[model samples]
Target: MDPAVTAAALDDEHRTFARLLREHQGIVATVAASYCRDPHDRADLAQEIAAQLWRAWPNYDPARRFSTWMYRIALNVAISAVRSAALRQRHAVPFDERLHDVADPAPRDPQAEQQIRALHAFIQAQAPLDRALLLLYLDDRSHREMAEILGLSETNIATKISRLRQRIRHEL
Candidate 1:
Protein backbone atom coordinates (compact mmCIF):
# COMPACT_ATOMS: atom_id res chain seq x y z
CA MET A 1 0.00 0.00 0.00
CA ASP A 2 1.11 3.58 -0.74
CA PRO A 3 2.08 5.70 2.27
CA ALA A 4 -0.82 8.12 1.80
CA VAL A 5 -3.27 5.25 1.34
CA THR A 6 -1.95 3.53 4.41
CA ALA A 7 -2.33 6.71 6.47
CA ALA A 8 -5.89 7.20 5.25
CA ALA A 9 -6.72 3.59 6.02
CA LEU A 10 -5.30 3.90 9.48
CA ASP A 11 -7.26 7.09 10.07
CA ASP A 12 -10.51 5.47 8.99
CA GLU A 13 -9.84 2.43 11.15
CA HIS A 14 -9.13 4.63 14.14
CA ARG A 15 -12.43 6.47 13.75
CA THR A 16 -14.38 3.23 13.55
CA PHE A 17 -12.56 1.85 16.54
CA ALA A 18 -13.32 4.98 18.56
CA ARG A 19 -17.00 4.61 17.83
CA LEU A 20 -16.97 0.95 18.82
CA LEU A 21 -14.99 1.78 21.92
CA ARG A 22 -17.57 4.32 23.00
CA GLU A 23 -20.34 1.81 22.66
CA HIS A 24 -18.71 -1.10 24.53
CA GLN A 25 -16.17 0.64 26.73
CA GLY A 26 -18.00 -0.69 29.76
CA ILE A 27 -16.18 -3.98 29.31
CA VAL A 28 -12.91 -2.34 30.29
CA ALA A 29 -14.34 -0.99 33.53
CA THR A 30 -16.13 -4.21 34.31
CA VAL A 31 -13.02 -6.30 33.85
CA ALA A 32 -10.86 -3.85 35.68
CA ALA A 33 -13.13 -3.63 38.71
CA SER A 34 -13.31 -7.41 38.87
CA TYR A 35 -9.54 -7.50 39.24
CA CYS A 36 -8.57 -4.23 40.90
CA ARG A 37 -9.72 -3.46 44.43
CA ASP A 38 -8.78 0.22 44.55
CA PRO A 39 -10.92 2.71 42.65
CA HIS A 40 -7.97 4.61 41.16
CA ASP A 41 -6.22 1.38 40.26
CA ARG A 42 -9.39 0.28 38.50
CA ALA A 43 -9.38 3.48 36.49
CA ASP A 44 -5.75 2.93 35.54
CA LEU A 45 -6.51 -0.67 34.59
CA ALA A 46 -9.30 0.52 32.33
CA GLN A 47 -6.91 2.90 30.59
CA GLU A 48 -4.38 0.12 30.12
CA ILE A 49 -7.07 -2.06 28.61
CA ALA A 50 -7.97 0.73 26.19
CA ALA A 51 -4.33 1.25 25.24
CA GLN A 52 -3.88 -2.46 24.63
CA LEU A 53 -7.00 -2.51 22.51
CA TRP A 54 -5.77 0.43 20.44
CA ARG A 55 -2.43 -1.32 19.84
CA ALA A 56 -4.19 -4.55 18.93
CA TRP A 57 -6.85 -2.88 16.75
CA PRO A 58 -5.03 -3.30 13.46
CA ASN A 59 -4.96 -7.07 13.87
CA TYR A 60 -8.68 -7.29 14.78
CA ASP A 61 -10.51 -9.71 12.53
CA PRO A 62 -13.55 -8.02 11.07
CA ALA A 63 -15.48 -11.24 10.76
CA ARG A 64 -15.72 -11.58 14.52
CA ARG A 65 -17.98 -9.37 16.62
CA PHE A 66 -16.21 -6.24 17.84
CA SER A 67 -17.41 -6.69 21.42
CA THR A 68 -15.94 -10.20 21.56
CA TRP A 69 -12.56 -9.01 20.40
CA MET A 70 -12.70 -6.11 22.83
CA TYR A 71 -13.74 -8.37 25.70
CA ARG A 72 -10.84 -10.69 25.06
CA ILE A 73 -8.39 -7.82 25.09
CA ALA A 74 -9.89 -6.28 28.25
CA LEU A 75 -9.76 -9.57 30.12
CA ASN A 76 -6.19 -10.27 29.03
CA VAL A 77 -5.13 -6.85 30.27
CA ALA A 78 -7.03 -7.25 33.53
CA ILE A 79 -5.44 -10.64 34.18
CA SER A 80 -1.99 -9.30 33.47
CA ALA A 81 -2.56 -6.29 35.70
CA VAL A 82 -3.56 -8.51 38.63
CA ARG A 83 -0.71 -10.99 38.23
CA SER A 84 1.90 -8.36 39.13
CA ALA A 85 1.55 -6.66 42.51
CA ALA A 86 4.42 -4.27 41.82
CA LEU A 87 2.84 -3.22 38.54
CA ARG A 88 -0.50 -2.64 40.26
CA GLN A 89 1.20 -0.73 43.08
CA ARG A 90 2.94 1.41 40.48
CA HIS A 91 -0.61 2.57 39.67
CA ALA A 92 -1.81 2.15 43.25
CA VAL A 93 -4.64 4.15 44.70
CA PRO A 94 -5.30 5.01 48.31
CA PHE A 95 -8.47 3.26 49.41
CA ASP A 96 -11.61 5.29 48.99
CA GLU A 97 -14.24 5.08 51.71
CA ARG A 98 -17.02 5.59 49.16
CA LEU A 99 -18.69 2.54 47.75
CA HIS A 100 -17.19 1.27 44.49
CA ASP A 101 -19.40 2.42 41.68
CA VAL A 102 -20.21 -0.32 39.21
CA ALA A 103 -20.98 0.36 35.55
CA ASP A 104 -24.44 -1.14 35.97
CA PRO A 105 -27.13 0.93 34.25
CA ALA A 106 -30.10 -0.62 35.91
CA PRO A 107 -32.15 1.47 38.28
CA ARG A 108 -30.25 1.79 41.54
CA ASP A 109 -31.36 -0.49 44.33
CA PRO A 110 -29.55 -0.24 47.60
CA GLN A 111 -30.52 -3.76 48.58
CA ALA A 112 -29.42 -5.10 45.22
CA GLU A 113 -26.23 -3.14 45.33
CA GLN A 114 -25.43 -4.55 48.75
CA GLN A 115 -25.95 -8.05 47.42
CA ILE A 116 -23.76 -7.26 44.46
CA ARG A 117 -21.01 -6.01 46.75
CA ALA A 118 -21.14 -9.27 48.62
CA LEU A 119 -20.95 -11.23 45.38
CA HIS A 120 -17.95 -9.23 44.27
CA ALA A 121 -16.25 -9.91 47.58
CA PHE A 122 -16.80 -13.59 47.06
CA ILE A 123 -15.42 -13.39 43.54
CA GLN A 124 -12.38 -11.52 44.74
CA ALA A 125 -11.24 -14.54 46.72
CA GLN A 126 -11.43 -16.95 43.80
CA ALA A 127 -8.42 -18.14 41.79
CA PRO A 128 -7.53 -16.14 38.67
CA LEU A 129 -9.07 -18.48 36.10
CA ASP A 130 -12.19 -18.99 38.21
CA ARG A 131 -12.41 -15.24 38.60
CA ALA A 132 -12.31 -14.83 34.83
CA LEU A 133 -14.96 -17.47 34.24
CA LEU A 134 -17.29 -16.01 36.86
CA LEU A 135 -16.87 -12.54 35.41
CA LEU A 136 -17.74 -13.87 31.93
CA TYR A 137 -20.70 -15.74 33.38
CA LEU A 138 -21.94 -12.60 35.16
CA ASP A 139 -21.53 -10.71 31.86
CA ASP A 140 -23.81 -13.29 30.24
CA ARG A 141 -21.31 -14.50 27.67
CA SER A 142 -22.48 -17.61 25.92
CA HIS A 143 -20.68 -20.87 26.59
CA ARG A 144 -19.11 -20.85 23.16
CA GLU A 145 -17.95 -17.27 23.53
CA MET A 146 -16.47 -17.98 26.96
CA ALA A 147 -14.63 -20.97 25.54
CA GLU A 148 -13.33 -18.90 22.65
CA ILE A 149 -12.21 -16.07 24.94
CA LEU A 150 -10.51 -18.39 27.44
CA GLY A 151 -9.14 -20.82 24.81
CA LEU A 152 -10.97 -23.76 26.28
CA SER A 153 -13.24 -26.26 24.65
CA GLU A 154 -16.96 -25.52 24.86
CA THR A 155 -17.37 -28.60 27.03
CA ASN A 156 -14.69 -27.37 29.35
CA ILE A 157 -16.38 -24.02 29.71
CA ALA A 158 -19.67 -25.67 30.56
CA THR A 159 -18.04 -27.81 33.17
CA LYS A 160 -16.18 -24.94 34.71
CA ILE A 161 -19.22 -22.74 34.75
CA SER A 162 -21.21 -25.47 36.43
CA ARG A 163 -18.57 -25.97 39.06
CA LEU A 164 -18.16 -22.26 39.59
CA ARG A 165 -21.88 -21.82 39.93
CA GLN A 166 -22.01 -24.63 42.47
CA ARG A 167 -19.15 -23.14 44.39
CA ILE A 168 -20.75 -19.70 44.41
CA ARG A 169 -24.03 -21.09 45.59
CA HIS A 170 -22.40 -23.18 48.25
CA GLU A 171 -20.22 -20.39 49.50
CA LEU A 172 -22.56 -17.48 49.15
Candidate 2:
Protein backbone atom coordinates (compact mmCIF):
# COMPACT_ATOMS: atom_id res chain seq x y z
CA MET A 1 0.00 0.00 0.00
CA ASP A 2 1.17 3.52 -0.78
CA PRO A 3 2.16 5.61 2.29
CA ALA A 4 -0.60 8.21 1.82
CA VAL A 5 -3.20 5.54 1.14
CA THR A 6 -2.12 3.60 4.21
CA ALA A 7 -2.36 6.73 6.35
CA ALA A 8 -5.82 7.52 5.03
CA ALA A 9 -6.92 3.94 5.56
CA LEU A 10 -5.66 4.06 9.13
CA ASP A 11 -7.52 7.31 9.67
CA ASP A 12 -10.69 5.77 8.28
CA GLU A 13 -10.28 2.79 10.57
CA HIS A 14 -9.91 5.13 13.54
CA ARG A 15 -13.10 6.92 12.47
CA THR A 16 -14.93 3.62 12.35
CA PHE A 17 -13.62 2.77 15.81
CA ALA A 18 -14.86 6.13 17.06
CA ARG A 19 -18.28 5.42 15.57
CA LEU A 20 -18.31 2.03 17.32
CA LEU A 21 -17.57 3.78 20.61
CA ARG A 22 -20.47 6.17 20.02
CA GLU A 23 -22.82 3.31 19.25
CA HIS A 24 -21.80 1.44 22.37
CA GLN A 25 -21.11 4.44 24.52
CA GLY A 26 -23.64 3.43 27.12
CA ILE A 27 -22.22 -0.08 27.45
CA VAL A 28 -18.71 1.28 27.87
CA ALA A 29 -19.89 3.89 30.34
CA THR A 30 -21.77 1.29 32.32
CA VAL A 31 -18.79 -1.02 32.42
CA ALA A 32 -16.55 1.84 33.52
CA ALA A 33 -19.04 3.00 36.09
CA SER A 34 -19.27 -0.49 37.55
CA TYR A 35 -15.53 -0.56 38.15
CA CYS A 36 -14.82 3.00 39.25
CA ARG A 37 -16.67 4.55 42.18
CA ASP A 38 -16.06 8.13 41.08
CA PRO A 39 -18.14 9.46 38.19
CA HIS A 40 -15.14 11.32 36.80
CA ASP A 41 -13.02 8.19 36.96
CA ARG A 42 -15.68 6.23 35.18
CA ALA A 43 -15.74 8.82 32.40
CA ASP A 44 -11.97 8.79 32.27
CA LEU A 45 -11.93 5.02 32.08
CA ALA A 46 -14.46 5.08 29.24
CA GLN A 47 -12.27 7.56 27.35
CA GLU A 48 -9.26 5.33 28.00
CA ILE A 49 -11.13 2.36 26.57
CA ALA A 50 -11.95 4.44 23.47
CA ALA A 51 -8.31 5.38 23.14
CA GLN A 52 -7.24 1.76 23.53
CA LEU A 53 -9.78 0.69 20.93
CA TRP A 54 -8.38 3.28 18.54
CA ARG A 55 -4.83 2.15 19.20
CA ALA A 56 -5.78 -1.46 18.55
CA TRP A 57 -7.93 -0.75 15.49
CA PRO A 58 -5.24 -1.27 12.86
CA ASN A 59 -4.88 -4.88 13.92
CA TYR A 60 -8.59 -5.59 14.11
CA ASP A 61 -9.67 -8.51 11.99
CA PRO A 62 -12.62 -7.34 9.94
CA ALA A 63 -13.91 -10.90 9.60
CA ARG A 64 -14.57 -11.21 13.34
CA ARG A 65 -17.42 -9.66 15.36
CA PHE A 66 -16.70 -6.02 16.20
CA SER A 67 -18.72 -5.86 19.40
CA THR A 68 -17.03 -8.89 20.92
CA TRP A 69 -13.63 -7.47 20.13
CA MET A 70 -14.71 -4.14 21.55
CA TYR A 71 -16.09 -5.78 24.66
CA ARG A 72 -12.83 -7.57 25.27
CA ILE A 73 -10.95 -4.30 25.00
CA ALA A 74 -13.38 -2.47 27.24
CA LEU A 75 -13.27 -5.16 29.91
CA ASN A 76 -9.50 -5.30 29.85
CA VAL A 77 -9.28 -1.52 30.12
CA ALA A 78 -11.74 -1.41 33.00
CA ILE A 79 -10.08 -4.20 34.97
CA SER A 80 -6.58 -2.90 34.40
CA ALA A 81 -7.61 0.68 35.12
CA VAL A 82 -9.06 -0.17 38.49
CA ARG A 83 -5.77 -1.79 39.53
CA SER A 84 -3.67 1.23 38.66
CA ALA A 85 -1.97 3.21 41.43
CA ALA A 86 -3.38 6.45 40.13
CA LEU A 87 -6.90 5.00 40.30
CA ARG A 88 -6.30 3.93 43.90
CA GLN A 89 -5.79 7.51 44.97
CA ARG A 90 -9.34 8.25 43.98
CA HIS A 91 -11.76 7.15 46.69
CA ALA A 92 -14.81 5.11 45.78
CA VAL A 93 -18.19 6.67 46.47
CA PRO A 94 -20.04 4.62 49.10
CA PHE A 95 -22.37 2.18 47.38
CA ASP A 96 -24.87 1.27 50.13
CA GLU A 97 -25.75 4.86 51.00
CA ARG A 98 -25.25 7.93 48.75
CA LEU A 99 -24.01 6.56 45.44
CA HIS A 100 -27.49 6.13 44.00
CA ASP A 101 -28.33 9.79 44.52
CA VAL A 102 -25.07 10.81 42.84
CA ALA A 103 -25.79 8.71 39.75
CA ASP A 104 -26.81 10.52 36.58
CA PRO A 105 -30.48 10.41 35.66
CA ALA A 106 -31.46 8.16 32.80
CA PRO A 107 -33.58 9.52 29.96
CA ARG A 108 -35.50 6.29 29.50
CA ASP A 109 -38.37 4.89 31.54
CA PRO A 110 -37.99 5.91 35.16
CA GLN A 111 -38.85 2.45 36.47
CA ALA A 112 -36.27 0.75 34.27
CA GLU A 113 -33.72 3.42 35.18
CA GLN A 114 -34.34 2.88 38.87
CA GLN A 115 -33.85 -0.84 38.40
CA ILE A 116 -30.57 -0.20 36.60
CA ARG A 117 -29.42 2.10 39.40
CA ALA A 118 -30.25 -0.56 41.96
CA LEU A 119 -28.33 -3.13 39.94
CA HIS A 120 -25.35 -0.80 39.69
CA ALA A 121 -25.38 -0.41 43.42
CA PHE A 122 -25.41 -4.15 43.83
CA ILE A 123 -22.61 -4.78 41.34
CA GLN A 124 -20.44 -2.06 42.83
CA ALA A 125 -20.36 -3.98 46.09
CA GLN A 126 -18.94 -7.13 44.56
CA ALA A 127 -15.34 -8.10 43.84
CA PRO A 128 -13.70 -6.50 40.77
CA LEU A 129 -13.58 -9.71 38.72
CA ASP A 130 -17.05 -10.57 39.88
CA ARG A 131 -18.23 -7.14 38.77
CA ALA A 132 -16.68 -7.71 35.30
CA LEU A 133 -18.25 -11.13 35.07
CA LEU A 134 -21.67 -9.75 36.03
CA LEU A 135 -21.41 -6.83 33.62
CA LEU A 136 -20.47 -9.10 30.67
CA TYR A 137 -23.22 -11.51 31.60
CA LEU A 138 -25.78 -8.67 31.79
CA ASP A 139 -24.65 -7.47 28.37
CA ASP A 140 -25.99 -10.82 27.07
CA ARG A 141 -22.69 -12.24 25.98
CA SER A 142 -22.84 -16.02 25.74
CA HIS A 143 -20.86 -18.32 27.98
CA ARG A 144 -18.50 -19.21 25.14
CA GLU A 145 -17.83 -15.57 24.35
CA MET A 146 -17.51 -14.62 28.00
CA ALA A 147 -15.09 -17.49 28.48
CA GLU A 148 -13.01 -16.29 25.56
CA ILE A 149 -12.94 -12.73 26.89
CA LEU A 150 -12.31 -13.67 30.48
CA GLY A 151 -9.81 -16.44 29.74
CA LEU A 152 -11.87 -19.11 31.41
CA SER A 153 -13.33 -22.41 30.29
CA GLU A 154 -16.94 -22.49 29.11
CA THR A 155 -17.85 -24.69 32.07
CA ASN A 156 -16.19 -22.26 34.45
CA ILE A 157 -18.05 -19.39 32.86
CA ALA A 158 -21.30 -21.24 33.35
CA THR A 159 -20.50 -22.01 36.97
CA LYS A 160 -19.29 -18.50 37.73
CA ILE A 161 -22.36 -16.96 36.13
CA SER A 162 -24.64 -19.26 38.08
CA ARG A 163 -22.93 -18.33 41.30
CA LEU A 164 -22.99 -14.63 40.40
CA ARG A 165 -26.70 -14.74 39.67
CA GLN A 166 -27.39 -16.39 43.00
CA ARG A 167 -25.21 -13.86 44.78
CA ILE A 168 -26.98 -10.94 43.14
CA ARG A 169 -30.35 -12.39 44.02
CA HIS A 170 -29.25 -12.79 47.60
CA GLU A 171 -28.06 -9.20 47.71
CA LEU A 172 -31.28 -7.86 46.28
Q: Per-residue alpha-carbon lDDT of model 1 for 1-172, expressed as tens digits?
A: 6999999998998899899999997777677767776666778888999999999988999999888888888878877876787865664322121334544455668898677767777777777778888878887999999888888899999999899888878877
lDDT of 2 by residue, 17-107 (tens): 7787788776676677667767677678878988888888878888877877888888888778777787867856223323334444435
Worst 10 residues of 1 by lDDT: 91-100
- The C-alpha lDDT values of all candidates are 0.78, 0.75
Error of 1 at 86 (Å): 0.7
Off-target runs (Cα >4 Å) in candidate 1 are 1-3, 88-102, 105-111
lDDT (C-alpha) at residue 133 in model 1 = 87
Best by lDDT: 1
| Pairs of colliding residues, candidate 1 | none
| Residue 26 alpha-carbon offset, candidate 1, angstroms | 0.4
- Tell me the lDDT of candidate 1: 0.78
CA lDDT, candidate 1, residue 167: 82
